[model samples]
Target: MAKGKEARVMIILECTTCIRKSENQKSPGISRYISQKNRHNTPSRLELKKFCPYCYKHTIHVEIKK
Candidate 1:
Protein backbone atom coordinates (compact mmCIF):
# COMPACT_ATOMS: atom_id res chain seq x y z
CA MET A 1 0.00 0.00 0.00
CA ALA A 2 1.11 3.53 -0.63
CA LYS A 3 2.11 5.78 2.24
CA GLY A 4 2.67 9.44 3.10
CA LYS A 5 0.58 12.48 2.28
CA GLU A 6 -0.43 13.17 -1.25
CA ALA A 7 1.62 15.93 -2.81
CA ARG A 8 -0.01 19.26 -3.40
CA VAL A 9 0.33 20.74 -6.87
CA MET A 10 -0.22 24.02 -8.62
CA ILE A 11 -1.56 23.40 -12.09
CA ILE A 12 0.02 26.02 -14.30
CA LEU A 13 -1.43 26.16 -17.77
CA GLU A 14 0.13 27.29 -21.00
CA CYS A 15 0.34 30.99 -21.73
CA THR A 16 -0.55 32.67 -24.98
CA THR A 17 1.14 35.71 -26.37
CA CYS A 18 -0.23 38.05 -29.02
CA ILE A 19 1.19 41.04 -30.77
CA ARG A 20 -1.69 43.17 -29.58
CA LYS A 21 -1.58 41.88 -26.01
CA SER A 22 0.97 42.79 -23.34
CA GLU A 23 0.34 39.97 -20.84
CA ASN A 24 -0.42 36.27 -21.12
CA GLN A 25 -3.09 34.36 -19.30
CA LYS A 26 -2.79 30.83 -17.99
CA SER A 27 -5.01 28.33 -19.77
CA PRO A 28 -7.71 26.68 -17.66
CA GLY A 29 -8.30 23.48 -19.60
CA ILE A 30 -6.09 21.20 -17.53
CA SER A 31 -6.80 22.88 -14.18
CA ARG A 32 -10.55 22.59 -14.61
CA TYR A 33 -10.32 18.96 -15.57
CA ILE A 34 -8.08 17.98 -12.68
CA SER A 35 -10.02 19.95 -10.10
CA GLN A 36 -13.36 18.59 -11.28
CA LYS A 37 -12.21 15.00 -11.18
CA ASN A 38 -10.47 15.43 -7.84
CA ARG A 39 -13.62 16.83 -6.34
CA HIS A 40 -15.83 13.85 -7.21
CA ASN A 41 -13.38 10.98 -7.17
CA THR A 42 -11.08 9.18 -4.78
CA PRO A 43 -7.57 10.59 -4.57
CA SER A 44 -4.51 8.71 -5.80
CA ARG A 45 -0.82 9.38 -6.12
CA LEU A 46 0.60 9.52 -9.59
CA GLU A 47 2.62 11.70 -11.92
CA LEU A 48 0.36 14.00 -13.90
CA LYS A 49 0.49 16.30 -16.91
CA LYS A 50 -0.04 20.03 -16.65
CA PHE A 51 0.21 22.80 -19.17
CA CYS A 52 3.11 25.16 -18.54
CA PRO A 53 2.55 28.82 -19.05
CA TYR A 54 6.19 29.58 -19.73
CA CYS A 55 6.62 26.64 -22.07
CA TYR A 56 3.19 26.88 -23.68
CA LYS A 57 2.73 23.12 -23.75
CA HIS A 58 1.62 20.17 -21.70
CA THR A 59 4.47 19.08 -19.48
CA ILE A 60 5.05 16.45 -16.82
CA HIS A 61 5.26 17.90 -13.33
CA VAL A 62 6.31 16.87 -9.86
CA GLU A 63 5.25 18.41 -6.56
CA ILE A 64 7.38 21.31 -5.38
CA LYS A 65 7.59 22.94 -1.98
CA LYS A 66 6.54 26.51 -1.78
Candidate 2:
Protein backbone atom coordinates (compact mmCIF):
# COMPACT_ATOMS: atom_id res chain seq x y z
CA MET A 1 0.00 0.00 0.00
CA ALA A 2 1.12 3.53 -0.78
CA LYS A 3 1.65 5.71 2.26
CA GLY A 4 0.06 9.14 2.32
CA LYS A 5 1.81 12.36 3.27
CA GLU A 6 3.21 12.46 6.75
CA ALA A 7 1.14 14.39 9.25
CA ARG A 8 4.15 15.23 11.38
CA VAL A 9 6.98 17.22 9.91
CA MET A 10 10.42 17.86 11.35
CA ILE A 11 11.29 21.46 12.10
CA ILE A 12 14.15 23.44 13.51
CA LEU A 13 13.85 25.92 16.32
CA GLU A 14 16.49 28.57 16.85
CA CYS A 15 17.09 30.63 19.93
CA THR A 16 15.96 34.25 19.54
CA THR A 17 18.74 35.49 21.76
CA CYS A 18 21.31 33.63 19.74
CA ILE A 19 19.99 35.09 16.52
CA ARG A 20 20.17 38.60 17.91
CA LYS A 21 23.64 38.03 19.33
CA SER A 22 24.94 36.15 16.32
CA GLU A 23 28.03 38.34 16.34
CA ASN A 24 29.01 36.90 19.68
CA GLN A 25 30.66 33.65 18.70
CA LYS A 26 32.59 33.54 21.91
CA SER A 27 30.85 30.43 23.22
CA PRO A 28 30.52 27.92 20.42
CA GLY A 29 27.65 28.45 18.00
CA ILE A 30 24.06 29.52 17.73
CA SER A 31 21.69 27.37 19.75
CA ARG A 32 19.33 25.24 17.69
CA TYR A 33 16.92 22.44 18.48
CA ILE A 34 15.46 19.76 16.29
CA SER A 35 11.82 19.01 16.81
CA GLN A 36 8.68 17.85 15.14
CA LYS A 37 5.12 19.11 14.95
CA ASN A 38 1.89 18.18 13.29
CA ARG A 39 1.49 20.21 10.12
CA HIS A 40 -2.26 19.92 10.26
CA ASN A 41 -2.34 20.90 13.91
CA THR A 42 -0.07 23.90 13.68
CA PRO A 43 -0.25 25.70 10.38
CA SER A 44 1.49 28.77 11.74
CA ARG A 45 5.06 28.88 12.86
CA LEU A 46 5.76 27.02 16.07
CA GLU A 47 7.33 28.79 19.01
CA LEU A 48 8.52 27.38 22.29
CA LYS A 49 10.61 28.31 25.30
CA LYS A 50 13.64 26.10 25.51
CA PHE A 51 16.98 26.00 27.31
CA CYS A 52 20.04 27.39 25.63
CA PRO A 53 23.48 26.55 27.01
CA TYR A 54 24.95 29.31 24.87
CA CYS A 55 22.62 31.84 26.44
CA TYR A 56 22.64 29.99 29.76
CA LYS A 57 18.93 30.62 30.08
CA HIS A 58 15.57 29.68 28.65
CA THR A 59 14.72 31.78 25.65
CA ILE A 60 12.02 31.98 23.05
CA HIS A 61 12.67 29.75 20.09
CA VAL A 62 10.96 30.25 16.75
CA GLU A 63 10.67 27.80 13.95
CA ILE A 64 12.83 28.41 10.89
CA LYS A 65 12.58 27.20 7.35
CA LYS A 66 14.53 24.10 6.50
RMSD of each: 9.7, 2.1
Q: Using Cα atoms with residue i matched to residue i, what is each candidate's TM-score against the true structure?
A: 0.30, 0.85
List model 2 lDDT by residue over 1-66, tens digit each. Answer: 776888899999999988878765554678899999999889999999999998899999999999
Model 1: worst 10 consecutive residues (lDDT sum): 12-21
lDDT of 1 by residue, 1-66 (tens): 994644544332222222113345543333212332232242443345766554565666543223
Worst 10 residues of 2 by lDDT: 20-29
Residue 1, candidate 1: Cα error in Å is 24
State model 2's lDDT: 0.90
Backbone clashes in model 2, listed as residue pairs = none
Q: Superposing every Cα of model 2 onto the true structure, what RMSD results?
A: 2.1
TM-score between model 2 and native = 0.85
What does the lDDT read for residue 27 in candidate 1? 32
